[model samples]
Target: MLTNVPGYPRIGSGRELKKANEAYWAGTASLEKLQLTARQLRRQNWEAMQQAGIDLIPSNDFSYYDQVLDMCLMTGTIPARFKPLLERLASPQSLELYFAMARGYQKNGLDITAMEMTKWFDTNYHYLVPEFDTTQQYRLLSHKCVEEFREAKSLGIHTKPVIIGPLTFLLLGKIKDHSLHLHSLLEQLLPVYLQLLTALQEAGATWIQIDEPYLAMDLNPAIHQLYINTYNRIHQAIPGLQLLIATYFDALGDNLATALQLPVQALHIDLVRAPQQLTTVLQQLPAGMQLSLGVVDGRNIWKNDYQLSLALINEAVQAIGQDRVWISSACSLLHTPYDLDLEQDEQVLTREIKHWMAFAKQKLHEIADLAQIATGNNTSLAANMAAMQAKQHSPLIHKPAVKARVAALDESHATRKSPFHVRQESQEVAFQLPLFPTTTIGSFPQTAEIRQLRAQLKKGTISSEEYHQRIKAAIAETVKWQESLHLDVLVHGEFERNDMVEYFGEQLEGFVFTQNGWVQSYGSRCVKPPIIYGDVQRTHPMTVAWSSYAQSLTKKPMKGMLTGPVTILQWSFVRNDQPRADTTFQIALAIRDEVSDLEKAGIRVIQVDEPAVREGLPLRRANWDAYLQWAVQAFRIAVCSVLDDTQIHTHMCYAEFNDIIDSIAAMDADVITIETSRSQMELLEAFARFKYPNEIGPGVYDIHSPRVPTVEEMSSLLQKASTLLPARNIWVNPDCGLKTRNWPETEQSLRNMVAAAVQSRSAVLVN
Candidate 1:
């Protein structure tokens, strides 16, 4: 019984990659230093897998930024805007070029916007969306897959090179040229995959793991045929080399029969998310295909169930031989934290709750332990069962009061006092303002001094009162600056907080923080997701003091910022013991308390951000309605507590909202701000088509890229948005938060954005 996994966490336990990448980007560290750090991290990851008894270690799964972006550079899917840099910059500066593509180029007298970015499938991790044109061509652009495979082999490790499958790569990317459909690039992308596969074969690779997560998605007959033809082509081209097609994050569903027809040696399915699909897969499984049973939960942190996994492995072995049955994590451990042992502080995740959890390192050991237990070794089963039993019976987990409160809640709790039209009128009276009101998406740039203040408070070097004063001073500076910018609908800049979700989770009950449990959200951006071990409750007002204080600073309407219920639930390592919807409802109740508190404190406007709600939509369309029902209910529960006169705003980013426009409308927020600049108001088209009644702030400036747009550029985007939806229904804003940006770029971008808005306003007045 061999233990296999599709991928492991690439970010180190301490986030060494993040620090090094930031240093290199800041020019404080050399390129050699960054490359060395990357190599060291890769070696450590490979060694960790080897030590954990992983039979099929994965290489090329580690990425400097994102694996999809790597695939983009590999397949010559480079955007045309980088042609000059590509031609001018020599080979040694390839890493620089890659970083330029990931983060847009702002220096060297060039201002190129980075490619569009969005949620990768249904996770917090973002990937750069590859842009394709009508004249797209594919070739062996980056030999990173081969280079990495050989790099690992140099250290005496036999590894399986992992690459995103061609079809999935094509499916995930967007077509920049309207003349091109994504599927039309199949022929163009195939030869490059063949070339790469051939190179891997020549480099002493026996097996290649081609990740086709697209298999788990909804597909029509045409797409199914695409899969059949694709695998057949690969099979004919490289007969000697074995290929493992890994699918995860969902069940194969109706595509199971079609999946069996593919010419791959082995196939992996996500048994964690969709265990019921195993019976169907076993029934339709081809004669010679190896089955990888993904029993260990990869997307979560909960310890694996030994008995359940052993039984599934036994059942599979009974159907096929033991040699053909393998155990692995359900999906990439990229979604989870790197290590759990780092949570040494007993004040955080206590020992009792820690026993029932597993990070990436623990998950690897769980995979190995499962294989060992299935093969007549029962050493670890007793401990696993003890932890499971403790969790089931623990007073820390179950709360009758919380459960009763949820049960007592009725439909009235999830409904606003009035509809949007009525609320809009009340809000207009509440906060009198001009058209195209300008505001940021809550946070301003988190500067070094502000971070130092928080660090000092944590370390006990600064008194609580001193820290409070410093935060107030930072807020004062921010408020004064926004006033100078002549912006409307101000925020406190969220200077006292950390990550949007983590800060709220810290003040709430039933959620545990981690000292070093970092997971990569994107390049150089890591988040430590709190663990939801028990029933949630709000202990105190999370942001009322800050919002009230900021509102006192200015006569203008100050928006109260909060991480909405769905986003909190989606971002956290939620408890597996109860239904996710139950936990979300608990969180909603908690946020509802805070919303009421803020409104009571004279906060006229509130912004509850549900950036993760769209990402939380079920992968299969069949399951979406139920999820959306609960998701929308949770959001409504959070904001509906406020009066109709209190203008409630919600912000969502990155994910496409076209399909879920009804649900978006169902959230019943008075205003919705979305990330649209990367798409050049393309997302606004959906809202326009849907005739979304509420006010929308189609972000005219791309905040993700550091390149500050010219006033003209932003006005152009505003004009584009106005043409789609009524100009009266539009607000002016940036795409997302400024937490990751610097003060210089953030100031310049906001200044340009304000100029654009004012320019738009002047034009409208003239009309």
Candidate 2:
């Protein structure tokens, strides 16, 4: 029996990667030390799996940043812009290319910026996007897969190496020059992959897992043929290396027929996501080809019912025989928390409930155990089955009030007090601002002192009164600064909040915080998500105090910031017992109360940020409408309680809003701000094509980097935006919140922003 998982968590259990990476970036740690720590982590991860009896362990899953970026570095497909910096660093071809692509270099005649990065597949994780041009060349920069496989072998473990397939890699990349199609780059990139596969075979790797998740997306007919030809070519070139082409996040769409025809050893499908794909997949299987059934959930923290998963696995075994069937997770465990074992000191009920659950480690064990059962290893199977049986019958799984409420849901709960056009007119009359008004996405810089004070308060080193006073002072200072800059709208700076989601989670019911729970969102960015336990409700207003106080200090409109219901649920550890839609609605009702409270407190403008809403869209288009229906309803329920005269705004970051343009318009926020500076405001083309009616603040500058945009640059971006969007419907702002930047850079960026807006207004009138 083969026992393996697609991928495991790379961010260490206690966020060791986050701390180590940040220290290295801040120049507090040496490269050699960081490398050693990463080595140790790899060893520790491997040993943990080996000890738990997992075979076919995956290597090269560890990445300093993202796996896709690492694949680009390994394949020698570095964009030409980073070449000068790579030459100057005198660094190894791999390390120099990788770091340069992740963080740009501006020294030694190298003034190139990093490629654009965005969220990866509905998770908080981000990946560096590969930039392709007509003249782009491909070669092998480093043997990362072979080296990692050898590293594991040196530690007395044989491993299967993994790589993102060429199709998905190209699909994820952008063609900067626009003349070149991604499909054309495939032939150039294929030889490098073949070379890597041959090296892995020489290094004693018998099985390789190539991820081609884009195959599950709606593909062009030409691309579908390309998948067949690409795999057939590779299989013919290297017949000895067994390849397992894996697809997840959705079922194989029109590509299923082509996927089955590919010359590969086995097929892995995500049963947890698309359970209906099982029968069709079994019927389509060719003789002698193995089936790696992905039955356990990988993206969520839910306790799996082994009995249910066992039934599915048993059916696969019945169809394909025990030897031909294996077990694994539906997708990578990189999206989940590390070990639930570390969360022992949490609430007793939650902790006890967690024992029924499985993290990466436990999931691996489950896969092994299920494989053993399939092979008639019955000694431990009975106990495991009984444990799962007990949990399914537990009282915690069902609550009458929650069930009744969800069943009786009405359409009225999902609608606003007034229609959008009426609300727009009323809001315009009440606020009365000029065309192309200036504002900021909520949050100013969260300084070291603020972070320290928050930590001190958590540790009981400071009183609540002291913390509140310090936060209030910070808010006042921020308002004064915005007034001095002559900005049109102001924000409270979100000084008291640790994160956009965690802050609201702290104030709501059915949620619990983790002391050491950390998951990597990007390179050095980590978030500790709150776990939702039971019925969700709001006991009190979350942001009213800080927002009302900030309004008291500012003559300008102070936008009250709240994380929207969909984002709060998406980013948190949600309950497994109830349907997610029910939990989302409960959260929506709770946020509705807060919105009403904010309006009652004289807060005229409120911003409900739904950054994760796009990420929560279902992977398959067939299932999209149902998910979007509930998600949009949840947002409307939360914000619709406020009066029409109250200007309700929503902010979304790092999303491709083209497909969801109708939904974005349906959201019906009076004003919406989105992250567009990274793409040169190209995302606004969607709004232009749709002729979107609402006000938009297409960001004038990118906030993810430390580079303070020049006034001329910001002015140029605003002028481009004005061409697509009506000047009256446009607003000027940064791409995102300033929590990651230092105060000095934040101040300089805002100054440039205000100056650019003033310049744009004058230029528009003259034209």
lDDT of candidate 2 over 653-753, digit per residue (tens): 88888999999888888889998887888889999999999889998877777667889988998999988988988998898898988888788889989
Give per-residue CA lDDT, model 1, range 166-280, as digits (tens).
8888888887788776567888888899999999999999889999998999988998999999889988998887999899989999888888899999999999998989888
- How does candidate 1 fare on TM-score? 0.99
Supply candidate 1's per-residue lDDT for 619: 92
Task: Give me the displacement of residue 331 in model 2, in angstroms.
Answer: 1.4
Q: Give stretches of model 1 more than 4 Å off.
A: none
Q: Whole-model lDDT, candidate 2? A: 0.83
Q: Model 2: which ten-residue window has the lowest total lDDT?
A: 346-355
lDDT of each: 0.90, 0.83
Clashes of each: 0, 0
Clashing pairs in 1: none
Candidate 2 clash figure, as a count: 0
